[model samples]
Target: MPAQTGLRPLNMKHGWPALALLPLAALSSIFNWNPAIILVLNITSIIFLSQAITASSVELAAHLGELQGALLSATLGNTVELTAGIVALVHGQIPFAQSVMVGSILSDILLVFGCCLVTASYNKDVLGFNNALAKTLSSLMMITAVTMLLPTALYASFPIAEINKKVLLFSRGTSLVLLLLYGGYLYFYLGTHNYLFISDNAETDSDEDDEPSSPLANRAKLALSVTRLIAAVVATIFCTEIVIENTSDMADTLGVTEVFIAIFFLPIASNSTEGVHVIAASRTGDTDSAIRVIIDSLLQIGLFVIPFLVVIGWCVAEPMTLFFDSFQTVAMFLAILVVNHLLRDGQYAYIHGAMLLALYCSLVVVMYAR
Candidate 1:
C-alpha cells in the first residue's frame, strides 16, 4: 500500500497539482466565477483529478497482481470519462457523448501514444517493444473499428424512415456483441495470456530496506490506498459534472463547435490519468508497458466504454447509437491506421511521434473548422 510511505518527505519533483487546484476549481464553480476562469479551473481540475486517480491506481496495483491491477487501473482510470459520457447522454447531448467516444479512441492512439513515444525517444534514438504484444492489440483495435463502422454503414444503407428507431435497435444489438467481445478480451488477457503483459525486469528497483516490515504498517498502507482511491473518484465525479455542464457555454464562448471540445479537450482531460502513467513508464524506459497502457486504454474505450454508454442510454430513455458521422468514422479509421504503421516495427522514434502529433493536430483543426 502507498500509505507505508505516506510520511516520506515530499519531493518537489512531482507534487500533486490536482490536489491543490481541486479546491479552487470547486469554489469557482460554486461561486459562479467568470466563465473563462471557471473554464480554466475546470480544465486544470480534471487534469489534477486524473493525476490523483493515477496515483491511487498505482497503489491499488501494488496490492493486486500486475495483470489484474493493470486492468483494474485502466477501467477505473476510464471511469471519469465513462461517467461524464453518461451524464452527457442522459442530458440529451448525444453528439457530445458520441464525440467523447470517438475522441477517446483518437486521443489514446494518437495523442497519448505519441507523447509516450516522444518521451522514450528523448533518451535513445529508437526504443523497441514486444512486437507480438503490439500486433495483437493492433489487430483487436482494427477489428473494433470494423465493428463500429458496421452500424453506421447499415444505417446509411437502409431507408431513412423511422431512422432513429432503426438506429436504436442496431445500436442495442451491436452493444451486446461489443460487450461480449470486451468480456472475452478480459478473460483472455487477464486469465490466459496474463504472462504476456508482465515484464521479467521491474521498471524501478527499490531496496527492500526501504519498506517497513511491520504488518501494521502494511495494513495502514492498504487503508490509505483505499481512502485516496475513494477520494479521488469522488472528487473526479464532482469536477467532471461541472465541466460537462459548462462545456457548451465554454465552447460557444471560445467560438468552436462542441465536437471540437469533445474531440480534443475532453479526451485529453479524461484520459489524463493514462497519459500520466504511460509517459512515466516511457521515461523509465518501460516502453513495453507504455505501449501496452496506450493500447489497452484504446481497447477499453472502443469495446467497453462505447457499449456501456449505449446500454446506459437505453436504460436512461436516451437511446444512443453507434452510427457515428462520416467524419468520426474516417478519423477513427485513420488513427488506427497510423497506430498500426507506427507500432508494426516494434520501434519508437521522435520523428514518428512528431508525425502522430501532427496528424492529431490536423484533425483538431479540421474539427474546429467544422
Candidate 2:
C-alpha cells in the first residue's frame, strides 16, 4: 500500500480549539446576538469545520488509489465554498454568490499562491516547480478567463431587457460547455497524464512510508473517516447557513458593501484551511505539491464551481449569469495574467510573491471603496 502523500490525518491540537468555537457560534445564532458577533463566531466555526472536512476527506481518500484519491480530495476541498455559495443563492443573493465565486479564484491564485511562494523562497533565492504543469494550468485558466469574458461582453454591449434572456441562455450553455471541459481536464489530470503532476519526492516518500495493516483494520479506519467527513460536511452546511443569514446584517453594521464583504472576507474564511495547507507544503520544500494545490483550486473554482452554480441558479429561477461586473472581470483577468507570467519559467522568488500580495491588497482597497 502506498502511503498517503498529501493527505494529513486530523490533529486534535488544532481541532479542539476550532471545535470549541462551534457551540459558541450556535448559541450566538440562537440567542439573536449582534450580527457582527454571530458572523464572527459562525465564520470561525465554519473555517474550523472546513478544516475538519479536509482532514477527514484526506483520510478517506487515502483508501482509494492515487488518481482517484487526488480527485476526491480536490472535490471535497471546495465543499465550504460550494456550500456557502449555494446558501447565498437560495437566499436570492445572486451578487453575493457571484462575488464569492470570483473572490475564491483570486484568493487561491494570488493570495494563497503568493503566500506559498514567499514561504518557499524565504531561505532560497528561487523556488521552482514543473514548468509543463504550470503552463498547462495557466492555459486552462486562460480558457476559463475567455469563457468569463464572452458573457460579460455580450451583456455589456446590449440593452438589459433585450440582453437579459440572451445572457442567461448563453451562460447556461457556456456553463455546460465549461463543465464538459472541466471533465476533460480532470481526465487529463488524473487518467492520462497524471505522472506529469505527481512529484518524484512524493512517490519516494510514499514508498518509504508504506506500512502493512490488516484488511479489517483498514476497513474500520475507512468507515470512521467517511463518517467523520459526512459529519463535518453537515456541520459546515449548518454553520454556513448561519453565516449567510447574518451576512447582510454584518455588512450593514460594518458599513461595507455586501459585495465587498463577499469578495474580501467570505473567500478568506472559507479557504483559510486550504491556504494554510498550501503554505505548509511550500515550507516543507514541496513546491510541486503546493503549486498543484494552488492551480487545482483555481481551476476547480473557475471550471467546476462557478459553472455548477450557474446551472443551479437556472434550476432555481435565479438567472445567474457569467457576466461579472466590469471591475471583477478585470480583476480576474489581471490576477490570471500576473500568476501566469510569474510562473512561466517555473521559478519564483520572494519578490514575486510580494508583488502578487501587493496586487491582492490593491484589489481589496478598490473593492472596499466601491
Candidate 3:
C-alpha cells in the first residue's frame, strides 16, 4: 500500500527551499544599497535563477538540457556585474568599471574553465589539443585583444583628450568593419567542413545528450521566438543599467578602481546565475551543460560585452581600448587557446582538465602579480 499525500503539483513541485533562495538572493542585493538594494536584487536574482534552472531542466531533459540551465545561471550572475558597470557609467565612475570588466573577463575564462575541468576530471578523459581549431580560436581572441588597443592607439596615435567627431567616426568605422569580418568568418567556419575538424565529440556521448522529442522549430513559432529573444536582450540591458548605476556609488566607499570593480565585482554580480548553475551541474554530473555555460560566457564577453562597452565608452567619453592594457586580456587569450587544444581531441580526460585548472590557477596568480 502506498501512502499518498494529497498535494497540488505546483505546491509539491515548488519546494520551499527553492522559493526561499530567490528572496534570499534578492535580499542579498539590498546589502549593497544605501539601505542596500543589492539585497533585494540579489535575492530576486537568486530566486529567478532557480526558477530558470527548474524551467530549463523540465523543458530540456537530456545532458544538453543542462546547457540552457547553465547559460541562464551565467546570465543572471553577470547581471550583478552589469548593474555595477551601469552605475559607474551614469555616475562617471569610469575607472571602477574598467577594473570590474577586467576581473569579470578573467573570471569567465579561467574560473569557469578551471571549475569545469576539475569536476569533469572525475568522469571523462581530459581533452587533447586540437591545434588547428585551437589556433583559430586563439587568433580570434588575439584579434579581440588587439582591438582593445584601439582606444590606446587612438589616444596615442591621434592625440585626443576628449571624444572628437573624427575619433568617434574612426572608432565606429573600425567597429563595424571588424564586426562584419569576424561575423562572416564565423558563419563560414561554422557552416564549412572545417567545423568537423574543430569539433570532435564521440558519437556515443552525443547520443547521451540527444533530445527525445523533435526540436522546437515547428511548435515554437519562429516569429515569437525572435521577439522573445529580442525582448529578453532589451530587458537585460535595461536592468543591467540600473544595477550598474547602484554598484558604482558603492565602489567609492569600497576604494576600488572601476577597472577592478568591473573585472571582479561586475562578473560576480552578472554571473550570479551561472555560478549557481555550475554548482548544480557539477552535482548532477552534467558535463555538456558545464561546457555550454563556459562557452556562453565567453561568447557574451567577446561578442556582447565588447561591442556594448565600445558604444558605452563613446557615450561616456572614455576609450574603449582600455581593455588591452589589463592583464585580464592576456589571461582571456590564454584560456581560449588552451581550451581549443584541450577540446580538440574530444576525450575530455582528467589530466587535460587538470592542466586547464593548473593554468587557470597560474593566471590568477599572474593577474595578482600584474
Candidate 4:
C-alpha cells in the first residue's frame, strides 16, 4: 500500500520512436539483415517497447487497488528481463542470461535508484522515504547477496569435476528456497501487514484527484490499458528474441564479450522503462513510491525472476544455476552493501547519488578491461 499518485494519462509520445522502428526491426529480422543492424534495431525497439509497457502498467495499476496494482507493476516491469533471460537460456547462452540477472538488479538498485535520488534531491538538501520499509528491503537484499555468494564459493572451493556435480543441485535447492521466501514476503507485506507500507498523504492526494466516471467508461479504459499492455509485451518478446539471436554477432562485430554486452547494454534497454517510472515518481514528490518502485523491482528480479529462470531451466534441460562468476558475485555483493549503507538512514542527497553512479561507472570500466 505504497502512496498512490494521480494517474497520468499514458504518454504515447514516449513510444513514438519505438512504433516507427517496429516495422523496420520486424523486417530486418525476417529478411536476415546484417546481424549488427538487426541487433541495433531490435535493441532500440525493445527500449521503446519497455517504455510503452511501463506506461500501460501504470495506467492499469490506477484501475486496480494499491496491493494488486503494485504486484502488476512489478511483474510487468520485469517482463523484459524475464523474457530476455528465458530466450537466452533456451539458446544455451548461460553466461549471457546470468549477466542479465546480475545486471538488471545492479542497474535498478544503483543506476536507476541513483538517478532518482539526484532528481529528488536537486531542489532540496535531502529527501527521505519510509525508513522501516527501506531497512526491510535492504535486509532482503543482503540475503540475496548471500545467496549469490554461496554458490560461487562452492564453485571455488570444489573446482574439480566431482564437486561440479553438487553445484547445480545446490543451486536448484537454493532456487526453491528463494521462491518460497518471495512468496512469504508477498504474503507478509501485501496481506498481513500492508498498513505499514501505505501512505496517508498519498491516499488523500489521490482521492482529491479522483473523478467520478461511468462504470462503462471505467471498463472501457481498463480494457484499453490491458490491451495496450499485452500488445507491448508481445512486441517486446519478439524484439527481445531478435536481439538475443544477434547478440553474439553484435559482440563479435564490436570485439567485446557477450557478458560485457549483457551487463552494460542489455540492462539499459530492459530496465529503462522502470528507471523512467522511478524518476517520474520522484519528481512528483512521491519519494516513497519512487523508493518502493526501485526496491520492489530489485526484489522481484532477485527473489522471483532469477529463481524462476533457474527453475524453468531445470525443466527445459538448460541446467541454469545461481552460480555466477567471481567478479559478478562480488560486484553484486558490493552493490547491495553500498546501497544498504547509504540508505540506512532512509535519506539521500545529490552527493550520495553521485557516489553510486561513480561506483557503477567504475564497475563498467573494470568489466570492459576484464
Candidate 5:
C-alpha cells in the first residue's frame, strides 16, 4: 500500500458549540419565544443538526469504501432537503417544492461545486478528478433535462389544463421511468461499474497494528454514532419545518416572492451541510471526494428526489408534474453546459471556480428579476 496523505482538519471548533442551540430552539417552540429569537435558534439548530449528521456519517464512512461513503454522505445530507420538500408539498406549496428541486440541482452543480473549487485553489494551482465519471454524471443530467422539460412542453403543445388527467398520467409515467433509471444507476455504479468512480491513486492501509481504538471503544463509538444519527434526524425534521415556516414569514415580511425564497434561501439552508463537506474536501486536497460530493448530490436530486417528489405529491393529494417553467428548464440546460465545459478538461482552477460562482449569481439575479 502506498503511504496515505492525511486529510486536512475540518476546522469544526465553532460548529460543535452550536449544538447547544438545539434545546433552545425546542424551548422557543414550546414557550412562544420571541419570533426573531426562535428563528435564529431554529437556524442555528439546523446548522448544528446538519453538521452532526455530516460528522457522524464521515465516521461511519471510515468503515465503508469511498463509493459507499460518498453515497451515504449524500443520502443522509439530502434528507433534510427531501423532508422539507415533502412537507411543503403536503401543504400544497407545489411551486415552492418544485422551485426547491430546481434550486438544489443548480446549487449543487454551481454554488457548491464552485465554492469548493475556490477553497481547493488555496492549496493548489489546479485540481483534477476522474473525468470519465464526471462525463457520465453530466450525461445523466442532460437526460434529466429532457425528462423535466417534457411535461412543460406537452402543456404548451396541447393547451390542456394543468390539472388535467393527461398531465397527471404523463407525470406519473415519466416519474416511474425516472425511478427505474435511478434504480438502474444504483446497480450500475455500485455493482458493475464501481471501478469507474474509484481513483487509482487511492491508498490501502489496513495493518492491524495501525488500529488505534480498542474494540470496546469502537463499539461505543458506533453506538454513539447511531444514536446521534437518529437524534439529529428527529431534530432536523422539527427544525426544517420551523425553517420552512419562518422563512416564508421572513419572505413575506421582506416582500420577496415565496418562489424567490424557495429558490435561493431554502436551498442554502438545506444544503449547507453538504456544502461544508465539499469545501472541506477541497481544502484537504481531496478533489475526488469534493467532486463526488457535488456530483452525487446532483444525481440524487435528479434521479431520485424529483421522481420521489412526484410520487409524494400524488400521495399527498396534490399531484405534481415534472413540469418546470421554460426559464427554469433553460437555466438547467445552461448549468449542465457550464459544468460539462468545466469538467471536460479534467482540471479545475481558481478562474473556473470564479466563473461558476459568477454564473450562479447571475442566475440568481435573473430569477429575482423575474
Candidate 6:
C-alpha cells in the first residue's frame, strides 16, 4: 500500500526477503500441516517485522513539524494488535483476548523497547533522556504492566508449591519496587546534574520527510491512497491470521512455551511492518520518532493484544488463565528498570539499545535453555 512501485533501495534488508517468502510460507501453512512448516511461516513473519523497523528508519529525517506524521505511520504500523483487538472486541471476542493485549503491552515495553534501546546503544551514543518526564511516564507504564497481579496476590492466602506464597508475593511486589529504585537512580543521575543518559548527537544530512520511495505527485493523487490503505490493512490481517494459526499449532505440537511463542514470535510476525520503519528512522537519525514508534508498539500491545487474548480465553475459561504470567511480569520489571535509568537525556545511542537488547536476549536464551 505504501508505494511498492518506485521502491527505495530497501536498506532494511531482513524483511524484503521475508515478505517475498510469505506467499510460499502461507501456502505451506495451509497445505503442509506440519508444525515445522508452521514454525517457518511464523519465523518469516519475524523477518518481515524486523524489516518494518528498518523501513521506518528514513522517517526520522523529516522536519520537526513533519515528525508527527512520521510518528503516526510508524507507531500505527507497529500496533496491529491494537487494531485487531478493537476489531475482535467489536466482533464480540473479549473474554480471553484481553489478557493477550496486556501481554502485548508487556512484551513491547520490555522486549521491543528493550531491543530498540539495546540496538540503538550498539549503533551509537544516545543523545540524552528527559529526566523528569520520562520517569513519570515510566512509572505509569510500570503500574499498568503489573496491575493484573491483583488476583494472584489477594487469592494466595496459603503457601503453595516451590514458589510459595511469600515468594510469589515478593516476586510481584519487588518487581514494582525495583522500578522505583531504577527511577530513583535515573533521577539522581540525570536530575541531580551528574550524568546524561543519551547521546547529544543525531544523524546528519537527513531531510526529515523526504520519503525515499515516493508514491505521490500532488494533492490529486490522494484518491489513489485509499485503495492502497485498504489493501494494506487486508493484507496485514490475512498475514496475521496465518502467523497466529501456524504458530499456535507449532507451539502445540512442539511443546515449546506458550509465552515464548507469543513474546518472541507473535510480535515479530505482527510487527513485520516495523522493519520498514526502523531503518527509515535510523537513517534519518530521528531517534525520538523511532522511540515513539516503540512506545506506540507497547501501547498497542497493552490496549489491543491483552484484550483480544482475554476474550478468547474467556470463551474457554475453565482450564487456563489468559492473564499475565511470572516470566512476563519479571521481564516487564527488568525493562522498566533499564529504560527508567536510560532515557533521561531524550537521546539514544548504541549502548542504550545494546543494554535493552541484552536483557531481552537473556530472557530468550533462558527460555530456550529450559
What does candidate 6's lDDT look like per residue over 1-370, in tens digits?
A: 1111112325544344555666776777668668776677645654554444334433321222233433344344544465444444444443323434544554555555655554444545435545554664565455545654544554465445533444434444444454355345334433563322222323222333234544455333334333333444455556555655455467777777554665556555555455344445545454444554555455334433343344443454421232345555566656665665565445666665656657667877876665
Better of 2 and 4 by TM-score: 2
Best candidate, lDDT-wise? 4
TM-score of each: 0.88, 0.93, 0.59, 0.91, 0.85, 0.59
- Model 1 per-residue lDDT tens digits across residues 55-156: 667667667765666566656778667877888987899888888888988898889888988888874667677888788888898888987788777776
lDDT for each residue of candidate 5 in 274-315, tens digit (9 for 90 to 100): 687678667756777677667767778887788888898888
Q: List the residue pairs that clash in candidate 5.
A: none
Q: How close is candidate 1 to the true structure, as a TM-score?
A: 0.88
As a TM-score, model 4 comes out at: 0.91
Please state the error at residue 264 of candidate 5 in Å: 1.8
lDDT of 3: 0.49
Off by over 4 Å in 5: 1-16, 27-38, 61-74, 121-129, 161-163, 200-215, 345-347
> TM-score of model 2 relative to the true fold?
0.93
For candidate 2, list the clashing residue pairs, or say none: none
2 or 5, which is superior by TM-score? 2
Where does model 6 exceed 4 Å of error? 1-22, 42-107, 110-127, 157-220, 252-255, 272-276, 279-285, 303-322, 344-352
lDDT of each: 0.76, 0.80, 0.49, 0.80, 0.73, 0.48
Cα RMSD, model 6: 9.2
Task: Report how far residue 324 has shifted in candidate 3, in Å.
Answer: 5.5
Across 311-369, the per-residue lDDT of candidate 3 in tens digits comes to 67777776543434545545665666666555544556666656766776675455444
Which residue runs does candidate 2 get wrong by more than 4 Å?
A: 1-16, 66-71, 156-159
Which regions of candidate 4 deviate over 4 angstroms? Answer: 1-10, 13-17, 62-71, 156-159
Range of the 10 consecutive residues with the lowest summed lDDT in candidate 4 = 1-10
